[model samples]
Target: MKPSLRPSLPLLLAAAVMLSLAMGLRQSLGLFMAPATRDLGIAVAEFTFAIAVQNLGWGLLQPFAGAAASRWGFRPVLLAGVLSYLAGLAVMALAQGGFSLLVGAGLLIGIGLACTGSGMALAVAARPVPAALRSSALGIVSAAGSVGALLAAPIGQVLAEGWGWRAGVWGFLLLGLAMIPAAWIAGRVDRVPIPALAPGESPRMAVALGRAMSHTPFLVMAGAYFVCGLQLVFLTTHLPSYLALCEQDPMLSAKALGMIGGFNVLGSLFFGWAGGRWNKGALLGGIYLVRSLVLGLYFAWAPTEASTMVFAAIMGFLWLGVAPLVSGLVVEMFGLRFQAMIQGLAFMSHQFGSFLGAFGGGVLFDLNGDYVLAWKLGVGMGLVAGAVQVAYALRGAAPPAAERPAAA
Candidate 1:
């Protein structure tokens, strides 16, 4: 890496724009699942299974993709990722059977998302920023993802309602296509010098994967991330339906979800900034603790439309706020040379949680008449996650006599 060069502001903007589009389009896929299942003759679990496959596949592929990008190049991997993303959209739009849905939406799109999602965005952020500013830059990239969700949720709803779900899929396809130029802008306009591993540096991918897997702090943090995913995705995917059952309009439900995504941008940026300035683990613990309290309070209050909206806004502020700091911790402990691979490994835990959250929530709702138990379980998990992350922070600290080298 050239110590003299700085990542231009335009490059940052370009990266953020591309990331936003990719995130918005991918996230909007869930909005179509329930409606599509009803229109097609597929079972609810079948649709849920497709999404679960998507998450599992993405998680599985992310590390490899990061490795490839690390070894070969970012531009080619990014192009390939875009193709996979678009192909997934196309197949989903035309799918006539479960096979098509699984292949298109589940395998292909999942792999595509792995290559292009937060892992890649963080990598991009790491490349340009000064070491001291890494956490803030990472947060900015993460906030871009939330911005996509903030916009995409409501837009997806409108397109699905007005133009048809298929049209919405196609619209997202067009959006994905637009990412090509942004990628070009953000990536190699010239043959940039490749970053080199330090002298005595281990092979990048192996070290990252092995180090993260072996580390106790990483394990605890990653495990807690799993719980966060379970709670967040479960609620996001099904909250609209839950609200509707409580006599709220579907549009209102969509708005609530959108609001969650919207406020999350602020939360993500806030936590990201805080991570740079303060103890990230403490901040993360506090956020999770607040989440647990909020969930319990919402349950007790018994949601009316006004109260539900208020609760949503509160929950929204905390929702996905953990992302930047969680990823930030990986960089803090491991450094950014192998950041993508390390982060991807942690993300696998996240996806596993998402799989359980998405599918399990559906199963629970189908089995029982109420989601009360699920909500309660979510609160419990939040507390546990908070404790785990706090423990990780304390345990991961360097030896008292040792000082960390500054990142250049």
Candidate 2:
């Protein structure tokens, strides 16, 4: 059957809500790091280690989750993710030390994120829409995903300040309950038939994986994606601490994160529209380039409230914009049949960078008592990666031989 030209509103809404909740809660967890560590009597490095583990676990399990969704359908996988999220938050709220933190925030939430995050949610959004509208649709969902952060950051910050860090996690738990229904609604995408494969294309997942692995452009794109993970995770995990170290008001971090979430909506929409008209690969590179420049500018000077908010806005606009570009590229290069799994493979690289950003930053801070070296390293790497991505994307390479249909 030919895919519908218009998107399925119900599916899009459901996917968007699920993504929003998953991302919002996950991003805001950083706010709890300072207070939670203090109250629980753990070192900053120990707390960050759990977050590092979360990134690693999410990365490691992502491909498997995608494959499971492809085989069993999105509903079961999504529902399982919701339960895990709830359980993870519960453990986090009641935790007494690092072990509980690791099990709750690291293991369970990581497992939950693998199922509920962008890979699975975008894959669901990509179905039922025609190719022409896929990028825009994915963008819309990604924008919605930012909403959670907007609300969660401020709320978590307030609750943590007023009641305690545990209350803040409990707040997150309450927000997570909403995802159950969203998952059920998004699951409807499973009913949409997969697009018919081209002649000579194999239905097997391994074929798609191998084709992607051998594709030069895909490899380069995936490599550049590592920087995206590194830079973003560093900010999310450490920005609050960084701001606190500057002796800024506690609420400043919340405001900055909220600004990022708010601006992310506009950025996602603009990029989604642009991805349809421009080269998605080049657009991804530009976002990285601009983001690195912004990072350098913000960190070079002492942060004021005005500068911090401005930085957050700029960063937010560049944030999550990659979702549409990357998802669209995956579909354009490979096919929808294995989009989740293929994207997951690329995301593994991203997670590795995230691990470094979270754990590495914490270690650097403990060693130096400052974030100077960490930000410098992130800026340097981002510049190189972004430049390479832009240059390589302009090359306009053809799809790998395996992806092209053989002569009959």
Candidate 3:
């Protein structure tokens, strides 16, 4: 294969760095929920709803951003994403009310994620790489975000407490802006393989999405990933509150979260490398299965600082581990032409789940004085998600493209 058959070093680095910055910054948002809300006199439900809005916005906008990237190159769209992210962060730093937080943390941040985070980053990074190396490449990129999380989480908490949550907002804003130089690197190419199409046989993104939606396997996969989002968001958004409820040291939540980020780096890399040697979908199923068990154990034992750290380390290793597999599934079935669009559609499910996780945790905690129900539900969902993936893998058939439409 020629050199162009693979992603260039700079392209991969740029995408990885952007993803790291975006994800790490976004994950740190949870740390601010408690402090910011208390200071602003915002209700937990209201604030959680604001965070949920970000997840919802991210899901809904990802497909559009991806489709736009498919038609235009990734650079302009990515630049737009950069601007949106910076604007959102700026608003957050200055915000003292719910409405401003809604605009900053909810809407603009979601738009930024749609453009610069997983959906577009994965597409740009993988599309330029050879099939065999794509999984490893995707893993490396995903793991980069974990590294960001490792560094950003503790720092975010410190900033939030020290400068008030507003200062933490400023810190994340600066980190998000760092993606600009990376965008310049990743923007150099937006190559998508185009096969010969018969006259009047154009392959539109809508058609691809329609095909994916109509497929049972794809639907099942999406449903499974919804649980993934829910599990993650619940932990990320509400862990601080949960700790406070249990009368544990407040710093412990930050420490656990930071550990999760640190271990997640290892998990992403391991999963990425493992996908090359194992069945991708099967690996995803296994990952979810382990998640269910881990969460069950977490709930079984009383919460302790040491136990929390242990759980975080274990969970972190599995965090975002399925990203490459699930994303790879889309590319495997549909090829690279519709990579961004189809993958975005799939991630939509993840973000929707995230919304439920973040908002639901707050609602449940507010109503019941604890997070027992949320944790139980997450465990059940994880089991279901695992079974769904396994079943889909066993029933593997050709993706909708080769069967009914022009090669995408």
Candidate 4:
């Protein structure tokens, strides 16, 4: 069957809004680490452990959420995520100790992210557009997803500074409420028809999983994705604390985070456009390479406000650009029937790295009294991942099995 030429504007807009809010608020959680830890007498490692748990939970449950969306519909999963998000923030706002923080910020928020984050949102965005336009569509949605951070980080910082950490969480709760409507709207993608299976393709999710797992390129991309999650999560979970330890003005972390969000928009769009015209695997590799170099340089210098902002801009541009490329690659390799689930599998690897990034960074800092070692590990792994990805892509990896013409 021919794919639809016209995209669904409402579905795309709704998905973008949902992704923006979900990611924006979650990323801003780092801002709370300093105040929440000091006021509640929780240690930094404990705090980051909660974040690590959040990433792990999100990673572990993501495939299930994606499968549920495949079997039931996107709406139910999305609504559940919004509710979980609100509950998590509420628990966080009212928390008096570590256990509540773990339950609220760690587990509940993890569940919410599994449902509402890039995997589900990008899958929704991919559905309405034709294959020709899919990459750019995913990019536009991914770009909009960055907008939430632009607003959320500054607002959370102001509220936390003025009122308390609780106030910042309460603000996040209010923002999360908007996701309900957005999810409902984006769920309209359920009405769009799935593309017919490619020749020799099986409709069963298990078969799709088997094929993707066996595919060499998919494995390579997913492995490199581990580095992607590690690098980003380290920054989001620790940058605020790192800055505080340096005695820089408290607001600089927020500003730097906001800058990353701003640049993420440009990066997502540029890569989205580029993915359409270039080898997505190579593009993914390039992003990883540049991002690693930027990270190394930034950490090598003693950070000033100017240098910090510049680093954030460059890193931000290189940030979520991976979302479009990764999502596009999954679709090209596997049909949309299980895009969410297969992508979820890759993201699980990313989140495991995220778990290490958040928790491991905290452990390293607690033990060593600084982040020098953590940054070094991240940069080294990222370089290897990028190189492998580039070499594989340049070798002209096979096209999607579904798209390949059959033998006579």
Candidate 5:
């Protein structure tokens, strides 16, 4: 029997909203770092490490969180995630010392994000959309996250300026609380139940999962995403500070971040559409190449507001575009049997990259007094990732025999 394609509008809307809020808030955390560090009298590295831990935690928890959602359903996981996120925000807000800040920002927020953030949301969203429209749904969800970044940066700056960093954190907590309703609504969408097999089913869930992990194409894609995570998270988390080092105006930093978010919508939509028509892995590989070229040009060219904005826009266009393609590739390779779980597992690699990106940038900058070295490394890795992806695509895929329906 064909699985039903239609899903309730309310469910889609809720997924989009929660996805937006979770992504945007997480992206905006970079804006808080400078001020938070200043107010708490902590080293920039310390805060960077905290944020690194958050990225690591988010990555590490994705597979398990996705599994939990898959097993118990998306609603419970979302609720738990949101509650944990709010508590983390509160912890950061009330923190009077470095240790408190570390616990809240590093550990608590990290785990909270793992549960409530994009990895889990995308999994839920994937369930409702038709197989053909899956890429587009992912684009919409990823774009929502970018929109969050667009809204969060300026708002965070304003709130921090007026009431202070503590108060600003409180604002994030309230917004997180508001997201609970969205999560609840997302849960209301009726799932197309996976019917129990009669006497024999294809393989057990565990066996299928293990097979996917060992799949060559999946591994290659996962590895490429790791590089993407490294570049993107590091840039978003540290770009504002890097701009500050260049002696640019503070508002310029926020505007740059907002510009990245704004342009990312176009990037994501473009790639998502392209993923349907093109060889996804090849398309993704090309994107990484473009990123490398853009970064190299930016570093070589003289720095000016115009140059920075233009570079930001170009980079933004390539930014989250990779997301839909990566997720789509997973569905293509494995079928959506355990999509969220598999995608989450892949995302762990990306998040691990994020951990390196966030913390390594800080460590490198502190040791070298410049971001030059980190930029160079990112360019090189981008090239390597592109090459790796193209190689994976050339290997090709075969249809699963299990996909044929059983005789009555």
Candidate 6:
């Protein structure tokens, strides 16, 4: 909020380190679903619901988190997030049933992620830097966060195998402690001008929220992002269990996740690079279409070790690349002033999709004893999401004025 506060390399580094720790821990939770559920004497449905709630919390709170950071300070919010996540891990370790799980995993960690994860990282890091170098700075921040993927799954697998899921959780908690200092270092924000409309003019915050809600292009974009959430959460949460059901080698599941993390580095870099040359919306549409095709390939073939690895690589390539495009498109459509709020709404749609995918997958599997139908549903949604993005691309960009809200 201090427009006078300068952005520095230390701030970027702090954001990067915080992101890596927060996301790394969140990504590793899927590996714990089975072990945790069994040990807690809970059904998969209840357990997954807790995680689903976490996603919803993360999405729902994103805008407010950004706003809080803007008004107060990014450091305080980031510090709160670190404490929240640590508390959630501690509670989850001791949780015995649904209530504790929901509160710990669902509420605490979800809000924690809101404060510490990419949304805050981008908003905080981008604010301090000059506009000219902003894009590269954002790119570095994104890459730093993605590195967490490479670390979490494999380490979780190893720790869960060697010690216990609780031990793994504790280890992650210790790791999260590192983020406290990183977030501290990166918490400074350089404030920018706030516009005051003329008499009879609508407030900018009201307009920004309204515009994001009402704009057809943003609506379609949000819908497409929903598919991203659904696909990712389902795979991350259920892939290991799904592999077990298929009687594939147990190690294959972990390896598949590990490969996803590794390959996504390339996917993120390539697609981000490509977005500059290609139409951003078109690239987004293409990524969704590619996901649908990948899902089809996955469903069409019998589950095999090789097939799973291929699926992971292909899917991972498509992973997270949507974010840069989405954020850029937001900038392309509007400017950066209310980017956090607008982008937060878009991300909310994504997390809602995550809620469905994570929670619904569990419910359907519990009822039907398989994920066949769930996978099919995800594919259908993916196709529709692809079409939505394509429609937005073809329609051409609209003026920022077209998206502004009427007076509240």
| Cα lDDT tens digits for candidate 4, 165-279 | 8999999999889999999999988999887767887888898788888899999999999999999999999999888888889999999999999999999999998999999
Q: Model 4: which residue pairs collide?
A: none
Report the Cα lDDT for residue 382, model 5: 85
Task: State each model's CA lDDT, in order.
Answer: 0.74, 0.91, 0.83, 0.93, 0.78, 0.78
Q: Give model 2's TM-score versus the native structure.
A: 0.97
lDDT of 1 by residue, 235-285 (tens): 666776676667766677667777776777788788878888887877877
Q: After superposition, how far is residue 17 of candidate 6 from its true place, in Å?
A: 2.1
Local error of candidate 3 at residue 5 (angstroms): 9.0
- What residue runs in model 1 are displaced by over 4 Å at the alpha carbon? 1-7, 189-200, 299-302, 399-408
Q: Count the backbone clashes (under 3 Å) in each candidate.
A: 0, 0, 0, 0, 1, 2
Question: Candidate 3's C-alpha lDDT?
Answer: 0.83
Off by over 4 Å in 4: 1-7, 403-408
Model 1 residue 396 CA deviation in Å: 5.8
Per-residue lDDT over 56-136 for candidate 2, one digit per residue giving the tens place of the 0 to 100 score? 888889989999999999999999998998899999999999999999998899999999999899999988887768888
lDDT tens per residue, model 3, 82-118:
8998999999888879999889998999899999988
RMSD of 3: 2.5
Please state the error at residue 260 of candidate 6 in Å. Answer: 1.6
The TM-score measured for candidate 1 stands at 0.90
Error of 3 at 378 (Å): 1.3
TM-score to native of every candidate shown: 0.90, 0.97, 0.94, 0.97, 0.92, 0.90
| TM accuracy, model 6 | 0.90
C-alpha RMSD in Å of predicted model 5 compared with the true structure = 3.0
